[model samples]
Target: MEHLFGVMLVWLLAAVWIFLLVSWAITGDVSAVEAAFGSVVALLLAIASAQRAFPYVVPFSLATLGGGAVALPVLRAYLNRAAHAQMDAELIERACLAYEFDPKNYGALINLAEVCYKNGLLEQAVRHLEHAIQQAPVMAANEKRRLRMWQDELQHHPKLGYTPCMHCGARSSVGAVRCERCRHLLLPLLVHGRWVPRQLVHKAVAVWGIAVGASALSLLWREQLTGLNALVAILATLSVALGLIVWVVRR
Candidate 1:
């Protein structure tokens, strides 16, 4: 029975890491380091204790850890781009620097186009937008139309640069109140390193409240954890790693 419990503990650890593996899919969460640490340690522990069938655990761990590693750099870059593209006076200079660094950079082209349009430089805006379209041929029709609308608008009108949705990282048009790709509010609050949805954060708080209350009641009704049972519980929680990950990502 203790052996069975040990196996269960390994499986529980596996579950914790599995969810954090595709961290790129939830880039909006902005908890890459936390996800990476949570996943890597749990995965290593699981692999050390795994039974038959997960022969590919080692390579798979690499994929999960590497995906998380990829996220951290991407997040840093996105934040840098956001700072440069927003209402800063050096928008043109920064965009040009990014373009020179990567001539085919889609974000750079889009930023240049918006800057040109805002300054009433129609031909330049069209040129940049055309270049941007080339970089992303699968651009939506509405998005294409949205970018070109600068042609009909007043000169020197503020055609601010595009920004990736804080939640989904999909590009959003200037002045849009919501992200077209994810339908999340465009303006999200920056908590810690992530721009999390206010509603989701509120929900997380309520979830914690309910969870704590339930745990407290259960503890009151039961004997205090000790010995082998306590050991199982600690292992099941990944030695507090899983709990910390949830808190950092949500809080």
Candidate 2:
């Protein structure tokens, strides 16, 4: 176990050094290596002091760490674009097939339309969304209206050739995955055809979680609840953190 940690530390430092070295090589910027100097040294010292690994140094300059702040965001944005550039064709086909199996379902139809729009089938997307709106029942009035608005926008605005938000009529750049006005995803794993703002649903859920958390804290303060009752409330409160972690990791 001790040897495993030592090897991991060695590989981690080597990886960081190589990354900075490569960044410098490609960008012809010394700051790429210099900016991480202090951090790398500190980590090495900490590991050596803990007797977990030997102290080592890379090609980084010994000067005070600075510069390269501007490069970070540019690098991150490039990576994000690269990540979303390719579509998983098989996944899309499966989604389309699933929607096909339930053509009469309004939510399914809207989902199909969203997929079609993403795949650049604008006419098909508009037609499916229009069908959803026409078939949507009274209970889905608000949702249907939202769909109607987007469908109408699509019909009138042929220049909206890019991906448009299902929730908002605003169109984003081609290959973009989110609406500029609404930061919610433009892709699937949607909730209820996502006619409702994801932000609203998140806020509602956060409020509910806060209420539950407060209840649990009050129970601890009062110390009056039974063991089972207290345990249940505490678990419910703790579950929020776990839920958020899962959502973030999966996303």
Candidate 3:
């Protein structure tokens, strides 16, 4: 029975590792260090399997401890790399998508332009912003204000050069809210012209809440954990909740 229990425990650990591995593949959440840690864990598991399958000279407990120590670092590196890769991919996608603006929807154009600007595609952003401003009315105060804002923003950051709108041939400020020549009101529909999908934010919050709830439950009812572990769990739960609240407010 004791031997059976030990084997079951090893299988359970392997299952958890498998779940993490799948999650890493889906989300790219693990870094190079974490990948290395996972490899180490696999190595240790192999050693343990060998020892269990065939009688080994080394003590079982020592082997298990050594396996754990080697696996931890590998996991850390893998997680870091995965997370970085995911972020890079998202950024690249956002940059590419920012240039696909609808001409009639000046608000969306401005939003896309702003996203492009933030992503370091400043020239493209400026061009889009100029187009939006040109479509605005010349006498509209709001449009003029927006144009001025963009112009001032570009002035301070000269990499985003002034480009006269092809439609109106106006040398308008990016900061101008309206076209000086045509008086088009260039009102932005979204905040800073960036399209933040509410769905993504909601999903992030939901995941954060679930993780926090799990952590709280683990800390509250877990007798297996040491006092320090319990405290850490509680703190992590609180931190996750706090972070979620902050993100929601900011978004």
Candidate 4:
């Protein structure tokens, strides 16, 4: 209900913006600044509302925003089609067939996951998600996080006879003795019917500690780091530190 309301509000704002722009262009009554400001606000509102409606459509970035703007006419024409694509069984089956033919296609895997999940095919959904995650090494962190969250949610639906890798969290077939990503030994499910790798847990704790410490230091010394040069230096140092830590953890 709230999403519907937001979409309606966005359309209303967009309509007003278009009316104002057209009126200004025709009569030359409204100031340029006013038109520009109104247009910007309307665009922002529309993007926000569209995100609520279609979270997986685009990443939130300036480049994506510009691309979305350029594609706005097409998007508006087929908005309903794009939004409800997953609900079409025929389309989903076609996507699944395509994925089977080319298992490495990350986009097809993700689409299959979504459609399967929506259709209550929990096991298939989980499998597709895991495959997508494994193949998407270069995917953005935010996108990977979203996929992980979805996989985690589906894990609780029912037993799929698969165990998650303790090191990289990828699901492994049951009775497997090693994780595919990190080659870490999978212990017997002696506790809680699941194996929890202590090394992985310790590494996670160390990473969290470093992140918290860095954030605390940044907050405490924010006033002193006033100049652009200082900001750049800090960012560079932190980036290097983070890169090293990630390399070590992945190794």
Candidate 5:
């Protein structure tokens, strides 16, 4: 409901901006300064409304802008993958919530575990898998075997911080800085408290590349571009860049 209201408000502000712009363009009576001011105010209002209505879009767009010097296709593929991951997470969460209404739904628990594993929530995934395994006796023999196999694999998965020692190939305990078998220093895997994935930082670099490239092209063809066209390009680029920053912080 709130999202719908925000979208409607944005459209209203956008319509007003268009009317003011058109009126100024056609009427010689309206001062350029006054028209520009009104346009700026309307644009800001519209952007605010958009943020409220489509919060994720803004951040994703901005992160794309920040992806400086990255190839367009690569950056796009990364974002697409991340978006899919997020969608899967949401779906799994919804399924888990639904399963809560019926605690006997072992399938939902397994699905939730798989999704959590893919999303790097290793500990949570392990817990879900264990729960599903406990409920496995009621399931078929093959199903029990499959669940056990998954649980075994997850128990040794490196992302859970139980990585193999470089020197002796023995697995180290979680948060272990050294290999217990060989006394070798293990590689540190630090998981920071980040709202957004580190991948967003890489995407932001590509975005910066696009912004710079566009600006350079505009400057090179300045004689072919009008003042309004140049202004629009600048504003569009800035908006995208800003949106990526918003996504990074909010995510």
Candidate 6:
């Protein structure tokens, strides 16, 4: 056991030395190598002073430790860069697809526009957003307001070739519903004056809020009712009940 401890300590010291050597090679500074060597010596002294420190980690082999010390940084950097590139590509593709499928999907358009603007594709982003506004349902007053703002801004800004009406190929506001030339509707008109039954939305929201609040309250006090086990069970049951209420109201 003492021999094993001696060998393991030697291996650890070697690993620390290897790390310092790599750092010295990268930075090419005499002071950096000296600092790293001092840190490793301090670490070794601390380990030698602690009798129980080496025993727990005895089963790991020296070769395994050495290879791991070298491989870890290389593997980590490769994985990180690969993941970042994949995410960026996916986000851009999703943004493009969203605009193509539903030009009026304003949330997606906004996300795409933001990305484009950040990356210096401002004109393309504006074109996408303008097209989104034009296609969005005009019945929603908020949507109309959004479209009006973008249109008002675009008119003052550098004019790109007008986005032709999707239906009639005539130059018009991206928000234009009916084509002036063909008389065909390019997008659904928002029903601004149409009445929604206020009672239905109000009742649904009220019931949902009450059920959720009751579930949260029950979860907080469940410990007194039956202890940890019962608390977990009751919390699970109440959460399910709350979810059911949400689903029903949404439907």
- TM-score of each model, paired residue for residue: 0.27, 0.31, 0.30, 0.29, 0.39, 0.26
- Give lDDT per model, in order: 0.53, 0.49, 0.50, 0.54, 0.53, 0.49
Error of model 4, residue 51, in angstroms: 59
User: Which ten residues in a row are the worst by lDDT in model 1?
Assistant: 187-196
What is the Cα-based lDDT of residue 239 in candidate 1? 34
Each prediction's number of clashing residue pairs: 0, 0, 56, 0, 17, 5
Instruction: RMSD for all candidates, in order, please.
Output: 14.2, 19.2, 16.7, 21.7, 16.2, 21.3
Order the numbered candidates by TM-score, best leading. Answer: 5, 2, 3, 4, 1, 6
Using lDDT as the yardstick, the better of models 4 and 5 is 4
lDDT by residue (tens digit), candidate 5, 1-251: 75556456455645655464457446633346544644554454456446542234333323332231134335445556655766775667565565666665788777766765666656556666666667766664765675566668767775545645556778876434356888754331111121345355554543444454344334433434568886776567567656765664466
TM-score of 3: 0.30
TM-score for candidate 6, residues paired by index: 0.26
Ten residues in sequence with the least summed lDDT for candidate 5: 186-195
Candidate 1: residue 66 lDDT (0-100): 47
**Candidate 6: C-alpha lDDT:** 0.49
lDDT against true structure, model 3: 0.50
- Quality of model 4 by C-alpha lDDT: 0.54
- Per residue, candidate 4 scores C-alpha lDDT tens digits across 65-170 of 3433444444333433433442354556556566657878888777766765665555656676777778876774655776677768766777657746556777
Writing each residue's lDDT as its tens digit, candidate 3 over 1-251 gives 66655655565555555456556646655444444444455445544544463333123423443454455346446445444444543553343344233345566556656655655445556666667677665634665676577667767775624434434656556544344676543222112223334344434434443443444345343444567786787677677666766665666
Give a tens-digit lDDT track for model 2, residues 1-251: 65555445544654454466457546644344333542454354334334432112111211101122333345445444433433323344444455557656666666666766665456556666666666766666765666666667667655545666667767765434446788645544222242343344334434433443344344453354567786776677567656754564445
After superposition, the stretches of candidate 2 with alpha carbons farther than 4 Å from their true spots are 1-72, 81-92, 115-124, 159-251
Displacement of residue 37 (Cα, Å) in model 6 is: 19
RMSD of 1: 14.2
Q: For model 5, what is the alpha-carbon lDDT of residue 249?
A: 48
Q: Return whichever of 3 and 6 wins on TM-score.
A: 3
